[model samples]
Target: MKLSDAAVKKAKPEAKPYKLADGDGMYIEVMPSGSKYWRLKYRYAGKEKRLALGVYPEVSLKDARERRDAARKLIANGTDPGEAKQAQKREGKIAAANTFEAVAREWVENRSNDWTAGHKALTLRTLEQDAFPSIGRRPIAEISSSEVLATVRAIEKRGALEIAGRVLQRCSAVFRYAIATDRCKNNPAFKMSEALKSPTRSHYNTIEKGGFPKLLRDIDGYQGSPMTTYILQLMALTFTRTGELVNAEWKEIDLDRAEWLIPAERMKMRRPHLVPLSVQAVAVFREAAKLSGDRVHVFPNRNDPSQPASNAIILRALGRMGYTGKMTGHGFRSAASTMLNENKSKWGIHRDTIELQLAHVEKNASRAAYNFAEYLDERRTMMQQWADHLDKLKAGAEVVKLRA
Candidate 1:
């Protein structure tokens, strides 16, 4: 018999259980405890089975009837509706577990051992601050390229074009990991970089080839802080980054061995780099040691001996010497590389030895690992020659012409 809404609602619960059947297999089971549950009964493959549709009035009369008809159709086609419903539940659970944030974090954790501490922290902070807020909860496989693009564009809105590019790169890495693990079909973040605003690349100002001599002379004549003067001398002789040189500790240097072993954590590439100090560099270091006394940093701040000198000091010193926009502390490296590479024939130094001294990472991984100290002896010779060449330039030696 068909059941009406009023009949189902007005029906009283008795001492025993009772049911009011709507039709087919749909029925409302009334319990003595005042509970009503929707149930379905059907036969398939010569067997009878029952399925719980839901509880009412949450399920309601109309929804229960629709479910009953749908289940009946499945039975007519020789399929079990109960099993299909269970499969759907399982899939929902899997998708919930494979969310973009979940997979991205897992990928990071799995690769943490291969990354430096700073690299790990920076990568996680970028994802947390930038990408995770909007789309992290969505399933990885369902994330569209447009959604990722919107996340990146948010960063661009703040005028951080370079950071936007980096965030997009991290997102792409996560998508690639998901694809490799079968959690996603494709890397949607891939090639989406074209949608981002490109940043304007600016090269550091540097002295011209013929201007090196004049630049060195000005630096020598400049009447700045004595510490600043010694710093300028070492900056040119070593050609190391301003940050690396300024933050140097006395313990990291070996004056007897004429070597400066910069630890991995301080280096930009996150690898230990060997700086073979020349006689000139050692003399400058000796002066720094006398000036710094027993302070922790070789170039401790004049006001605060506990901290290293500010990196801005180098640029300011150059500016004070009237070299503003003509040279930078970093320009020393470019100047050194240019002269060394051009004079390689006369200098009799291999390009690889010069590159190692510059602390540039090798593109080939296997070769880099095995040859980290491949040409230490050769680098020592090259470092001395480089220092001597600087002295000649400072003395106004005639410029040598390159062979055509």
Candidate 2:
């Protein structure tokens, strides 16, 4: 029987502090202290359950009726609202306890001290941009292979093939990090290499990228960040990794001496590298230093002053100028290795010095192990000439090299 509001009003204050005479599952319980709380009565799994509907006035009789209808629909769908609420609470607790984002942060802090600040920032940026939106809130142990594959495939759809590849590799490393700590037993991201295979036809080749001087001409016109332009130019001159170049500290440089000392930890071979700075290389730093303020890194992220630009910053800048098909950050090495070796004498640069400057590991382990001679003096001279070669290109002069 549905009792009218007027009837309840006539009997409520004197008899029961509050009661739902006409409502299905709504009532106000007035405590001994004279405060009222709304309660919802429902039957679930063959038992009656009382669900709190919040405090009265806050959860008024009209608002309580709306909530009652929502709960009843859950029951009609075979879901117990009370049990679902408890399960949801458990999910929230577990998500915070074991989320993929949480474990990855742990991995970055714990397992990645060897990574330079530049690399660390880049790694985190990739995760935050490409991976987090989809699965960051999921428990680390619950991120399925399908979820990861979907994320990378989405990057591929945007034509970031190389970035997709790197994301796959880093995602695999994070899951491995989780496994090492026993946070997860199975790597859903493991052995899924074929999923990333690109179908788009590439019309350009990396090995032959340097022979195309027109491409270099195109790069000269790129109006992207001047820092990125200078960066690519330096990569060509030094053949250093993008991370190393951007993270170059002022202390490591000697302008009067024409040298840049990259510490052993920063080198790929885990040995200290002496870059004999060319005239142009020295000039590049002086300009970069002024533009970067006193920030420790040569190329700090514009959006974030704490660290260098992400590894993709230069590459993406290249992409904006249509060089994505023809070149990459690592491609500068191939260009230098090819052009330097091909035109050594033509530019007054020496072949032995160019090879030594490249630190091209002598293939034989025995030879490399025995080799302590880093050809410091000759490489220094040759690096200056190499920088001059680029200037010649800018000036349209023919390359002239010394007789070997």
Candidate 3:
């Protein structure tokens, strides 16, 4: 018999459970405790099975009939509704476990060996701060391209276009990882680069060769912390990245060998780098040793001896030397690269040797392992000659072309 909403409500519970049938294998089972639930009973493979549609009046008469009809259709197609319901429940649990944030975190952890501490932290922080709040709990497989776009666009709206671009890139990587792991089928973050606003590109300020002599002279005469002077001098001599220079440890340097071996963990390319020290560079290191020899870092922070000097020290010193917005610590690399390439023929230095010294070799993992020491002998000579050339310029001597 078809049950009415009023009859289902008015029907009192008996000494035990009783049911009000609504036809087509649908019924509202009323228990002795007065709890009501919607149930569907049907035959599958000649065996009767029951499926819980929902609880009433939440399920109600109308909704229960709809669920019953749907289950019947599944049965007519030779599928068990009870089994299908169980499969759906399992899928829901799996989807909950494989959320976007879950997949992203897994991806980051899987690549931890390849990334530096700072890089890994920055990548995670970017996602947590920008990408996670919106779509983090959603299943990775269900995240659409528009959803990823919206996440990055929110970052761009805050005037962080560069960060927005980076977040998008990381999200794309996370999606790729999900795909590889079978958590997701497609990368929704793919091909969405054109939607982002381009960030303004600015080059580091650097001086030309003609201005090198005066800059060197100014650095030498600068009235500041002796540590600052030495750092500035070393920056010009080594031309290493600022972070690499500031975070240098005493253990990594060998005064006798005239080499500074930066470990793979500290390098930008995740490869160990060997800086062939010249006589002048070694002299500068000696001066630094006198100040911080007992400390861990070669340029330990003045206030915090345990930590390396802040990376901004060089920029602050340059600004004090009246080179504000004109030259930067990184400008040393630009100056050195320009001068070396232009004078390669005259100085008899191989381009490959110069590039190796600059740590600009191919980034293939296997190749990087051995490439750090490639052209060591030529690089050692090149370093010495380059340092000598800088000394000549600093002394206000007339620059002359060297014979090959």
Please report the candidate that would top lDDT against the real structure. Answer: 3
Worst 10 residues of 1 by lDDT: 395-404
Hey, what RMSD does candidate 3 come out at?
A: 5.8
RMSD of each: 7.4, 9.1, 5.8
Per-residue CA lDDT of model 1 for 1-404, tens digit only, reads 79988988897899999988888978899999889999998877778888899888888888888998898899888899988889989998898879999998998887775565657878999999999998899999999989999999999999999899999999999999998999999998889888889997434688787888888887778798989988888899999988889999999999989999988777776778889899888988998889886999999997888999999999999999888998898898988988899888898999998888888878887666834567999988888888888888888775442211
Candidate 3 has what TM-score?
A: 0.72
lDDT of 3 by residue, 114-139 (tens): 77778789899999999999999999
TM-score of every model? 0.65, 0.53, 0.72
Better of 1 and 3 by lDDT: 3
> Any idea what lDDT model 2 has?
0.73
List candidate 1 stretches off by more than 4 Å.
Answer: 1-138, 150-164, 180-183, 192-200, 207-211, 322-329, 398-404
Clashes of each: 0, 7, 0
Local accuracy of candidate 2 as per-residue lDDT tens digits, 1-404: 65444543343343446565436776666554556666778888899998876775566566766777888899999998888779989988867967888887777777455565656778899988888788877888988999999989999999898788888888898899889988888898898778787646432234354344655555566687778877877887798877788777767777778788888677655456788888777777778778885887778788987777777876787688776766777777777777777877776666657766776555665666523236777777777767777766665677654321
Query: lDDT of candidate 1?
Result: 0.87
Instruction: Using TM-score, rank the candidates from best to worst.
Output: 3, 1, 2
Which has the higher TM-score value, candidate number 2 or candidate number 3?
Answer: 3
User: Which model, 1 or 2, shows the larger lDDT?
Assistant: 1
